[model samples]
Target: MRLLLVEDDPMIGEAVLELLRGERYAVDWVRDGDMADTALRSTAYDLVLLDLGLPRRDGLDVLRALRARRDRTPVLIATARDAVAQRVQGLDAGADDYVLKPYALDELLARIRALLRRAAGRAEPVYEHQGVSIDTVTREVRVHGQPVVLSAREWAVLEALLARPGRVLSRAQLEDKLYAWKDGISSNAVEVYIHGLRKKLGNELIQNVRGVGYLVPPA
Candidate 1:
């Protein structure tokens, strides 16, 4: 999935960027709050990693503005704001969860997973539709009770589609979920990955909607 990371610290931002990239997420990071606001205004993201202490605009204000616009994109507050009052304020401002600085990366990832799962209205960590099973935590995929290996891009496309079965996602929508601002995506990247997935899994899995886009129909 795609994410926006709003962090000003160079070291922290670099580390988190690498971590998220390693996890196969398309992440765009902006150092200042203004840049974060601008990015939020222009694009749609699956999640936002926000820091309260920010330049130009405070992270809280940025979040307030986002809520004012009625954007329900999940926001995870990761900052040094460790005080109880500050945490309450962030929750009140619309943050889905909070993680303190110097936090364990594993815990952060777990929190992110939980938020994403909740946003998708799923209580289980594993996503299953039509005998295709995906374990988000283990990064494992199984088709019809057997194991199946998928390349990173293929997995991204598959997960994006299977996140909500019966929903149609156009090419542009899939591209947005798979690419960040700096990532160079090929013209036929989605088709390539979809083809790869179809070859590995069954051809019946990911159906095209004639002139529309792709969909994972409900079982």
Candidate 2:
């Protein structure tokens, strides 16, 4: 998944960025609301982690602007603000969820997973089709009841294809999900990862549409 992290505190931003990246998410971090608003306008993200205290513009304004543009991307507000009114206002302004500043990283990850699950219209973390099964939480893949190992990039590609099952995801879309702003992606990076996934998972798992990119046929 690709995520936008809007945090002003260096310690918090650095920690969250590393954590999300380690979880195999493509994360773009901005330290202020202005930059966050620009990113929201320019790119498509799977989710957004936003902090209420920001520079240049208020975080609440950012959220309102995002909603004003009719962007339905999920937003999770993480801030030091703990007032009941603040939490209610954030929800009223269109945040999908909220977490306090000193929250557990494990719980934060859990909330992220839950939001992703809801966005995908799925309740289960394990995704299964035919003989292949993948546990999103465990990062485990099994084929025909046998464990299979996949590289991080390969796993990312497979997960992207599985995210919407029958819907085709263009190479550009997949690339967006696999890389952040600083990462250099090869011209054939998506192809390479897709090839790796096919070889390890199954030849017929990801279907190519010749000109339309790829998809996992509906089960």
Candidate 3:
């Protein structure tokens, strides 16, 4: 899963990044609210970790802007202030959850998991599609009840395709979803991953629409 982390403090940002990456989450970290806004608007992220004290713009502004635009991506506010009024304000401003400073890494992770689960509208983290099953939270995949190992990029490609079954996802769209802006995309990277998936899963699972893109089941 992908998450956006908006934090200005280097130490805290690094700590959070390490923890989330350890859990197999692809996270994009930004130092200011403006960058956070840009990333949130451009990227399809599962959740966001927002810091109230941000540069360029206040965190509340970022939260309000996203909500005003009808972006339903879940956001968890991380702030040093733990006052009831502040918490209420953050929640009212569209934060899905709040984590106070000096919190345990475990607690932060738990909150992130909860927000993602709520955003996905499911308590279970597994996504089942016929003979294939994917644990979105754990980044684990199984084919026909057996484990199927996939590289990070392969898993990302699979995730994007599985997210919208039956829809013909263009190579550009898949590229946007699978890789971050900083990561350079190859010309036939999407095709390569698709071929790999077909070889592993089954040729009948994904279909090419001639000159267009690819389509998965829900057919």
Overlapping backbone residue pairs in candidate 1 total 0
Off by over 4 Å in 3: 22-24, 210-212
Q: Model 3, poorest ten-residue lDDT window?
A: 174-183
* Selected candidate, larger TM-score, 1 vs 3: 1
lDDT sort, best first? 1, 2, 3
Q: Positional deviation of 206 in candidate 2, in angstroms?
A: 0.2
Name the regions of candidate 1 deviating beyond 4 angstroms.
none
The lDDT per prediction is 0.94, 0.92, 0.83
Can you rank all candidates by TM-score, best first? Answer: 1, 2, 3
Q: What is the lDDT of candidate 1?
A: 0.94
Q: Taking the candidates one at a time, how many backbone clashes does each contain?
A: 0, 0, 0
Model 2: lDDT of residue 107: 91
RMSD of 1: 0.7
